[model samples]
Target: MNDGRRKVLKAGVAVAATLGIPFVARAQSKPVKFAALLPLTGPFAFAGNAALEAFRDATEYVNEVKGGIGGRKLELLVEDTGYDVAKGTAAFSRIVSRESPDELLFVYGDSTGLSKALAPEVARLGLPYSATSFSSELADPKTYPTIFVLGPTYSDMMAGLLGEVRRRKRAAKIALVYSNSEFGKDPIPFAKAQAEKLGMQIVAEEVTPLSMPDATALALKLKQAGPDFVIMQGYVLTVEPLLVRAAKEQGLNATFMGTYYSAELALMQRGGPATNGFVVTYHNAYWYDSLIPAVEKIKQFRASKGRSISYKTTYYMGSWFVVDVLGEAFSRAAKAGKLTRAGVVESLNNMGDYNADGLIRSMKFVNHRLPYIKLYRANVQDGRFDAITDWITVG
Candidate 1:
């Protein structure tokens, strides 16, 4: 075997010894199932695959180092949704039907549309569910008691970004460029309201497909509008690079910023020189933040797969965060002698100041969402985004 695989096997052996269990017996226990609906074949395939890899690494860590949740290994069940709401919902239904709800510890939805579509059903079934979406609607604990959001809502991130813009450039004229989807349009209304409240002018609002044939038209439109800043939403990797390149080529001199989904390493690598000075809002620290012990651990695990963690995208970090949060909830529920769906929800509700091993700031849930946000600027020379501001909490 390769050296990395040998190291991982050695680590597993050490963990089994520490737990006072034979390695074979430890591997034989029933597993806690986690079902994930991912868009592995469509526009967001890159992000889905990254998230799946992170999930796999985290599950392996849990089963090895952590001895699993309450002594049970984690078995991940992933289905490809192709970034379609209908396909995602159907996949979720099929998975849940096949797996016992008790065995299935939690469910993860890959898109905002999928999350919204599955919310009612998840609530009806009283199954604990989380999603990659940052939609404000999912933060409603009263409406969807069993659902959890891993980070700030899109509206909150927009508000935080606008707050930063106002701080740097008072009364800035801003344009909103987003994808034509539920994910893209989720925060527009709230953003408009917040912009009005903050005295920032809404210069232009443009919509483009998630995968644009060309961003020339939109870039020219933004140039004509003459906004001081442009905020991009509803994209993982594709549209941002094209839009930024087209805008720069058209001589559009506006500062570009993006929400969580658009703030990814892949964007910088793809956009190249155009990504210089690009700013983004995010809740978690990037994989390069080795100061975070969890990030270091992730790097080691990723190396076992013959990959570098620095190439990981924001979706990858978000997926690992979800796994960490779920592991914490499972531990808490097991301690309370109630390792069930209701118990997990209660544990999640009671959690406070969790930082996911320093990958994020001390996060607290308010209205079922963490209200923290941070700003980062792409350092093109280093090909990484460096934080420009500390955690900013939105009200």
Candidate 2:
């Protein structure tokens, strides 16, 4: 074996020793395969890279430290989709067809569009699937029997923000600003319904491209509408900051909040002063929240790679939770003597509250979605989000 392979095998042996398992026995066992699709070279590349690292670390932990799922080494097959639906679909097809069906127990999708596009194929393959998206459409257990979301849907997140608005300001005037993509437009109808249910006035609804080079017009529009709160949804990293800054410059007297994609340290850093007092919802703990064992593991893993822990983000935490959930399902399947894709789906369906090592609260799947959501305010000074409230269960 090459020097690198030799070292890795030695480390695996050491890990096996710690688990009280013989290396020879583990070497004889086969591997459980997982296929991952990531947006590595596209608009979401930064977030995708962070998630990729988290998956790598989680796979290492499962194989080396945890002695793999049921004594079979965890093998991960990853491909870059560049955030394109067609590319993602092609990648999924290639992976499923190329890999052994029995060995490939689970698949991870990169985007909401991809998840929805491949739902039929996933069901046809009879494999349990997870994704980076939390689209409400994917949460229907009847429609997507094997699909699982890591947290609340976009609609639930919007509802959480609206509930917060109503709690803080009675009969508040709210506006919904979103991008023009599947991700951005996913929760607009639900959010509007929620506003109506809360008796909040829907003042302005604006749609912009994912990359809003000049948000001055939108800012002016929002300024004129003068809503008490403006909820930004379906943006990954750019539009929200520009809108928040432009709106602030335009003297828009509204509290700005965002859905999950806008809740990141990168946003705070990019928006600087404008992001001050900005609130966003998150389904996973931040990197600075090292109180959790999983977070600590991420820290150590990054340190081992000669990188700072600060490089990790909320996206990384989310992806780690994805893999951890898969590990849990695999374990349960093994226990049931049904370690195939269908078995994993059955295990996921029967799962109760799972906290992913306290990175989030005890998550119970309601219609294949976790109903936990938490609010965080941007601390521009530190470029991090501070919890504004405890975990709120969304209906």
Candidate 3:
């Protein structure tokens, strides 16, 4: 200590001692924050809202239940990007600049576009990035070291779908249908290659807009192609049902299928009769599977707060699965005493088979994405999805 400062501190201590007063040092516990860029108001509001709810509950579980990480409470910092790429990038920039690396452990972004746009920046900052996107492009650890996909890449999901096609009918004729967007088109090439590998034929490849100008025309085109099955990509709730109805009206007897969002319980309700035989692939358990521990925790937490729900969307369940994975990483990092971004990434890379109470099956990230998934068949009569196959590793 400097002499002048030391003498002043000693004089203060002596005065306090003579007055029977004691001096104490004060320190505040810091929070390990996971900053999120979510689209809470625009096109993807439904998704963002579902995810936000999970983030909130997961934060509570960590801090209140598990005593937080290394005694530093976990915090969720959300910046609404309104599903806009430009705004998402702006939020990422602001968050990285404003948050201290010591406290900011992870960042969760909205979509494939935002993930691609911020790849360079995330790598530069060395901040661990996870996203709602499962684009095949984002699975590259070499290019985007800090970025990871929450589930299997679209390509991996496609493999599971096409494998199902091959299972239902060897040498199955498959038609590819997707919206002409990044989400829609990301897995086509890979699907084609996988189809070829599995000895299946690509009968028709159809592209539609986010809003179908004429749904009938697309259905007629598929009928003309005469494929035994049609696989959809790049859409959530709109085109799958419409085209299935149109194709049925045309007397086309092809099985229709989708992956991820398409297989959601919401889609089953939305599609009605059209979704009866529709097939989809997913990586995690649905929200209604209350027997699962983590999901049970969500149910319990909400009920304790008088905000319980009978059911939630797939996005909600999927979002919780993401949080559980992050929690695991944070826990590992804390135990190792390297609760930083790099430390979390190291733990993630080496996280071989994580059993998060069956939120996901042996959740493992290969090439920064979960390569395992399961197949489900929608039963319109029950308004629920039934598992058709056990967990399959595709990617």
By summed lDDT, which 10 consecutive residues of candidate 1 come out lowest? 21-30
- Runs in model 2 deviating more than 4 A are 1-28, 304-307
Best by TM-score: 3
Q: Write the per-residue lDDT of candidate 1 for residues 198-287, one digit (tens) a residue.
A: 899999999888797889999999999999999998887789999999999999999999999778777878898998989989888687
Q: Across residues 1-395, which tens digit of lDDT does each residue of candidate 2 receive?
A: 69999999999988878876655665448689998899999898987888898899888877777778888888888999999999999999999989988899999998889999998988777778888888899888787788888789999999899989988999999989988888988999999988998899999999888897888899999989989999998898789889988988999979999988888888878887988989999888787786778788777866786876665677888888888888888988988989988898888877676687886676568888888899999999877889999999997
lDDT of 3 by residue, 1-395 (tens): 69999999999998887765322221136678898888899867988998898788777877887788767778899999998899999999899899889889899998888888898889998999988888999889999888888788999999898888887799989999998888899999999998999999999998888666457888888888899999999887778878887887888899999989787776766556876888899888887666778677788878887886678878888877777778888889989988889999998887777867787777567888888898989888888888899889886
lDDT of 2 at 144: 74
lDDT by candidate, in order shown? 0.86, 0.86, 0.84
RMSD of each: 10.3, 8.8, 3.6
**Could you tell me the lDDT of residue 30 within candidate 3?**
68
Which runs of model 1 end up more than 4 angstroms from their true locations? 1-29, 302-310
Compute the lDDT of residue 218 as modeled in candidate 1.
90
